[model samples]
Target: MFQKILIANRGEIALRVLRACKELGIQTVVVHSTADADAMHVRLADESVCIGPPPSRDSYLNIHQIVAACEITGADAVHPGYGFLSENAKFADILAAHNITFIGPSGDHIRIMGDKIEAKRTAKRLGIPVVPGSDGAVTDEKEAKRIAGEIGYPVIIKASAGGGGRGMKVALTEEDLEIALQTARSEAGAAFGDDAVYIEKYLQKPRHIEVQVFGDGFGRGVHFGERDCSLQRRHQKVWEEANSPALNAEERSRIGGICARAIADLGYSGAGTIEFLYENGEFYFIEMNTRLQVEHPVTEAITGIDLVHEQIRVASGGGLSVKQEDIKFNGHAIECRINAEDPRTFTPSPGTITHFHTPGGLGIRVDSGVYSGYKIPPYYDSLIGKLIVHGRNRVECMMRLRRALDEFVVDGIKTTLPLFRDLVGNADIANGDYDIHWLEKYLAKEE
Candidate 1:
């Protein structure tokens, strides 16, 4: 086991990794930007170092400063808690060259899965199902049009290196394909410095189902289950639930086994998610996240597995402790990504939190990094915390989620709490009758 681990991020995820390290009796070093001098993770870390000023590029995203922090603190391993450098293959390679461990998959695996185009090819080669689409990057307008024609109309153009809904456009007909391709390429070049884009047969009502997978880097792996992150806005997941309400035991088992086998075949270590778009009776691969997801708590809540601890163990050369058959899924879990934003307008809300309260009960868990007087800086992501609830079944889980939401409170800044309150009571959300596009349509109606 590592004696000390450096956390290379901030906010709730940083705090989450810190707590996990503490539980395993490992000392922790937390790096923070000047804007996060008083951040919760820094305050609670065994040791803290100020990396640089905020605006992430100079601070949280600076690789050299992070390496210096690790060297200064004698941190043998780094747990990048999502975002920033988590998926940077070069960062992982650099750490390894310095004799420091990155508590996730290898740089090779990260490189293969980070690019959407390559990931699709790898997924297909691994026997995973994928949507019918172009074999590789559609470079020219002619190639884009040809793929769209073959796939039928209503194709989607996506950046080969894109995420967060950027560099993506949908064309309902052949006439719209040109504009969609041009816009997607332009956005791709601007956002990712890569003008490569691909085409896929767009599914109208697919549910965003992602399987949670873990590996030991020794050709061994296991899958917990699936999470339904269908409730999204602008391609961002707002709410997520484990054991997707849309899938049954047979479907879940089938996809989960496929993902577990794929990860094992790749010799992947630590936590990763194989995301898919599920519609009717088929599951089509969308992409793969090479690090722990923002919505991991829901999966932890259902499986009773401490993923962070497992990540640390596997990265430290310890093989997987639980076998696939030994792992059991117990209950339904839901996670609400509580962000500092206007519920109605979806604008960023950055300010001091004057009053703060969190709900606590048998099935409710809140992971937050803010206090009453904490200042939410605008330089970083708007997320403040996550509220996860678990219950014996879906019905019980929703009821518990509703009760917990009523008790969550934050003041002196706008938040999306009200939005969750409404979602919990809506007939569609209540019955799990929602897709990736459902929230966008619902929000449009309200506007």
Candidate 2:
């Protein structure tokens, strides 16, 4: 076991890792930007270091500074919680060269899975189900058109190196494919510094469900089951729930076994998510998240497992403690990401939180890093905390979430609490019939 670990993240996730480390008897050092000197994670961590100023590239994304902080703090391992450099293969390699463990998948796996096209090839080789798509990046308009023709019309063009819906465009019919390809390539180049784009058959009104998988270094793995993250806005997940009401018994057996086999085939290690877009009873592989997801707490609520501790133990050369047969999915869990943003315009509202409160009860859990006096910084991500609720079933879960979202509050700045209040109370959400586009159209109708 590592005596100390450095948390290379900010906001609530940083605090989440810190608390987990404390419970596992591992001291944690937090790396923060100059703007986050007074951040809550810094205060709660055993040690804190200022990496750089406000900009992410010079600070949180600065690989050398994070490495230096670990060296100075005697942190033998670094946990890249969710974002920033968490999925960067080079960052993992850098840590490895320094003899410091990265508490996730190995660098080789990261490199292979980081690229969408390459990951598809890997999945293709392993007999894992993948959506029909281009061979790889389409370098010429002719290649793009040829692939589009073969895949049929209305294909989705995506950046090979992108996530979070940054560089994506849908081309309906052949006439639109050329413009969509050029635009998507430009966006990808500008956003990710890679002009490479891939094409895939797009699923209409798909439910984004992902299987939570954990693997030890020895090719043994198990899945904790799936979470429906279809409650999303602009390709970013706002709410997530486990034991998706849409999945049946046979579907559960199929997806769970497939996810486990996929992880084992990749020789993956630590905690990673196998994301799939399900529509009309067909589940197609979308992508994989190479680190702990922000929605992990919901999985924990259902499975009653400490994923953070599991990640630590696995990184320390420990084999998986649980097997596929031993894992059982139970109950239902829901998570609402309480962000510091406007509910109407979806803009950042960075300021002091004057009055802050989170809900608590038998099945409610709040993961947060801010207090009433804490200032929400403009330079970082808007996520403030995650409000999670667990129940015996989906009906009970929705009711619990309704009450929890009502009780949760924040003042002195705009918040999505109002948006959530309306969402939780909606009949469609309560009835479990909402799709990916349902919220956007519903909110548009209100406007």
Candidate 3:
């Protein structure tokens, strides 16, 4: 086991990793930007280092500074808690070269899965289903048009190296394809520095389902079922739930087994999520997240597994602690991403939190790094925390989530709490009758 681990990110996820390290008797070194001088993670870590200024490029994303911090702190491993350098293959290689383990997959795996185009090819090769469209990146207008026509129109153009809804455009007909391709490529080049784009058959209404998978690098793996992140806005997940209400036990088992086998076959290590677009009894691969997801709490709640703890152990060369058949799914769980943003406009809200009150009781958990009087800086993500609730079933889980959301309180800044409150009360959300487009449509109606 690593004596000390450096957390290479901030906010709730950094705090989350810190706690896990503490539980496993591992000391922690938290690196923070000047903007986060008084952040909760820094306060709670065994040691803290100020890396740079507020801008992410100068601070969180500065690889040299982070590596220096690790060397200075004598930290043997780095747990990049999502975002920033979490999926950077170069960062992983740098850490390995310095004799520090990255508590995730190898740089090779990250490289393969980080590229959207290559990820699709790898998924298809691994016997995982993928969307029907172009075999690879399409550059010329003629080839783009040909693929769009073969896919029967309504095709989506996506950046080969993009995420979070950027560099993506949908064309309902052939007339829209040209403009859509141009816009998508432009956005791709601007956002990712890569003009490469691919075409995929666009599904009208598909649920965003992702299977939580873990591997031990020694060809052993297991799955903790699926999380339904269908409730999204601008491609960002707003709400997530475990054991997707849209899928039955059989479907869940089938998909989970497939993901687990794939991870084992690829010899992947640590935590990874295989995301898919599910519709009408079919699942088309979307992309794979090479790190822990923000919505992982819901899966942990249902599976009785401490994923962070497992991640640390596996990265330390300890094989999987639990076998595939030994893992059990227990209950329904829901997670609401409580962000510091206007519920209506979705604008970022950054200010001092005058009051912070979290909900408690059986089946309710709030994972946050903020407190009363904590100033939410404008330099980083506006997420305040995550509110996760678990119950015996979906109905019970919904009731518990509603009660918990009411109990959650934050002041001195706008938050999306109101949005979640309204969503939990809606008939569609209550019945889980929603798809990837449901949240946008609901927000449009509100407008």
Candidate 4:
């Protein structure tokens, strides 16, 4: 086990990793930007270092400063919680070269799975079902048109290296294809420094379901279960639940087993998620996240597994402790992402939090990084906290989530709490009758 671990990120995920390290008797060194010097993670860590200014390019994303902090704190391992450099293959390689363990998958796997096109190919080769799309990146408008025609109308153009809905466009007709191809290429180049784009048939109203898999990098792995992240806005997940309400027993078993086998065959290590789009009782691979996902808590709530602890253990050369047969899924869990934004307009809200109170009760958990008097900077993502609840079933879970939302309070700044409060009582949300575009359309109606 590592004596000390450096957390190379900020916000709740940083604190999440810190708490995990403490439980395992491992000291933590948190690196923060000047904007986050008073952040909760920094205050709670065993040691804290200022990396750079508020800008992410100079701060949270600065590799040299983070590496230097690790060297100064004598941290033998680094846990990049979720964002920033978590999925960066070069970052993992750099840590390995320094003889510091990265609590994640190998660089090779990251590189292969990070690209959207490559990930689809890999999934198809592993016998995992994938969406019908171009064989590779479509470089020109002519090729894009050819691929889109072959896939039929209503196709989506996506950046080969994109995420979070960036560098993506949908074309419903031939005329739309030219504009979509050009715009997607430009956005992809601007966002990821690669204009490469791929085409796929866009399935209408598909549910976003993802399977959580863990491996030991030796052709051994296990699947915990699946999370229903179909509740999304602008490609960002707003709400997530474990053991999707849509899948039956047979569908769950077959898909879960397929994910486990694929991961084991690929010799993947640590924690990763294989995402799929489900429509009409068919699952098509969308992409793979090679790092811990933002919605991982729902999975943990049902499985009772400390994914971070397992990540550290496997990265330290330990094999998986649980097998596919030994794993058991229980109950249902739901997570609501609380962000610093206007409930009506969804505009960013960055200011001092005058009064903050979190809900507490049986099976309710709040993972946050803010406190009363904490100033939320506008330099990063709007997400400030996540409220999670578990219950014997989905109905009970929704009831608890409603109660929890009513109890949550934050003053002196806007929050999305109001939005959730309204959502929890909606008949559609209560019945779990929603797809990926459901939230967007609901919000549109409200507007």
Candidate 5:
């Protein structure tokens, strides 16, 4: 086991990793920007280092400063808690060269799965079903048109290296294809420094489902089941639930087994998620997240597995602690991303939190990084916390979630709490009759 681990991120995830390290008798070193001087993670860590100013490029994303901090603190391993450089292949390679372990997959695996085009091809080779699209990236508008026509109308153009719905466009007709292709290419180039784009036949009302898989470097892996992240806005997940109400035992087992076998075949280590779009009882591979996901708590709640502990153990050459058949899934869990944003307008809300009180009870958990007086800085993501709850079933879980939401209190800033409150009372949300486009349409109806 590593004596000390450096956390290369901030907010709730940083604190999450710190707690895991403490439980395993591992010291934690937290690196933070100037804006996060009063951050909760820094306060709890065994050691803290100020890397740079508020800007992410100069601070959280600065590789040299983070590596230097690791060297100074004698941290033998780095746990990048999502975002920033968590999925960067170059960052992983640099840590390897320095003889420091990155608590995730190898640089090669990250590189292969980071690119959407290559990832789809790899999934296809592994016999994982993917959405019908061009065989590879389409360089010109003519090729894009040809591919779109072949795939049929209502196709979507996506960036080869895109995420968060930034570099995507949909064309409902041939006349819209030219503009969609040009816009997607331009956005992709600007965001990822790659002008490459791919085409896919867009499926209407598809549910966003993802399977969580863990692997030991020695070719052992297990699946913890699936999470339904269909409730999204602008491609960002707003709410997530484990053991999706959409799938039965047979479907869940089959998909979970496929994911685990795929991970083991790839010789992947640590934690990763394989995302798929479900429409009409069919699952189509969308993409793979090469690092821990923000919605991982729901999975943990149902499985009772300390994913961070497993990650560290895998990096330290310890094989998987649990086998495939030994794993058991219990109950239903839900996670609501508590963000500092206007519920109605979805605008960022950054200010001092005057009053704060988290809800607590049986099966209710709040993973937060803010306090009563912590000022939410505009320089980062709006997410301030996650409210998770578990119960015997979906109905019980929804009731607990509603009760917990009513108890959660935050003042001096706008939050999406109102939206959740409304959602809990809605017939569609309560009945699990929602999809990727449901939230947007719901919000539109509200307007």
Candidate 6:
């Protein structure tokens, strides 16, 4: 185990890693921007360092600053708690060359999986089912149109190197494809510094499902099951649940095995997620997240596993602690990303939080890095906390989430609480018939 570790990110996830470190008898160091000087994670960590100014580029995304903090603190490992530089392969590469262990997949794995086109090809070669589409990146509108014709209409053009729903355009006709090509290429280039874009058959109402995988460097790996992130807005996941209501025994085993095999083929190590789009009982590999996901808590709630501890152990060159037979999921768990934003319009509402009261009780957990009097600066992501709940079943889980959301009180700054209140209580979501587009259409009708 690492004698000490530096967390290279902020917010609830940074705090999450801190707690795990404490439990493992490891010292914790936090790196925050000037704006987060008073953030809860900074206050709670045994040591804290300011990386840069309020802007993320100079702060959270500044690899040198983060590495410098680690060097100064005499830390042996770094835990990138999602977003920002978590999936940035170059950052991981620098950490490797500096001899500071990055507590995630190797930079090579991240680099390959970071490119959507390369990832798809890897998945295809590994025999993991991928959505039928173009052979590679489309360099021209004519090529895209040609591929779309063969793959049928309603194809989607996606950035070949990034996610979070950016640089995505849906074309249902040849004319639409021609118009979308240039714009998508431009957006893709701007977002990821790569002008490459690829076409894939877009499922009209697919459910987003992902299998969580953990591998120790010794070639041993096991899965922690699936997260149903079907409840999304604008392609970003808002809430996630474990042991998806959509998956069955046969399907789960098939997907899990295929995903494990895919990562194993790459000699993947540490924690990662294989995300897929499921529609009409078919699973198509979408992409792989080469780090711990934000919503991993819900999986922990259901399975009673500490993923961060596992990551650290793996990074320390320990084999997987749990076998395949030891894995089990019970009841249901849901996590709502409590962000400082207007529910209706989804705009950043950064301000001082006058009051903060988190829900606590059986089956409820709150992971956050803000508190009363904390200022939510407009310098980063709007997410302030994660409100997760577990129950004996889906119905109980839904009801518990409602009560938890009600009990969660953040007096200042607009939060997605209102949107969640209106969402989980809705008949369609509660009944589990909602697909990936459910939240979008639900919000649209509210107007």
In order, candidate lDDTs are 0.95, 0.89, 0.95, 0.93, 0.94, 0.89
Tens-digit lDDT string for candidate 4 (28-79): 9999999999999999999999999999999889988989999999999999
Q: Model 4 RMSD to the real structure?
A: 0.9
- Candidate 3 at 433: error in angstroms? 0.6
Poorly placed runs, candidate 3 (over 4 Å): none
Q: Which stretches of candidate 5 lie over 4 Å from their true place?
A: none
Write down the TM-score for model 2: 0.98
Q: Distance (Å) between predicted and true CA of 213, model 1? A: 0.4
Q: Can you write out model 1's per-residue Cα lDDT over 336-425, one digit (the tens) per residue?
A: 999999999989999999999999999999999999999999999999999999999999999999999999999999999999999999
RMSD of 3: 0.6
Error of 3 at 389 (Å): 0.5
Candidate 3 worst ten-residue window by lDDT: 144-153
Candidate 2 per-residue lDDT, tens place, 266-325, comes to 778999998888988988887888899999999999888889999999998976878888
Clashing pairs in 5: none
- Which consecutive 10 residues in model 1 have the weakest lDDT in total? 139-148
What shift in Å separates residue 142 of candidate 4 from its native position after superposition?
2.8
Select the stronger candidate by TM-score from 3 and 6.
3
Assess the local accuracy of residue 123 in candidate 5 as a C-alpha lDDT between 0 and 100: 93
The candidate, 3 or 5, that scores higher on lDDT is 3
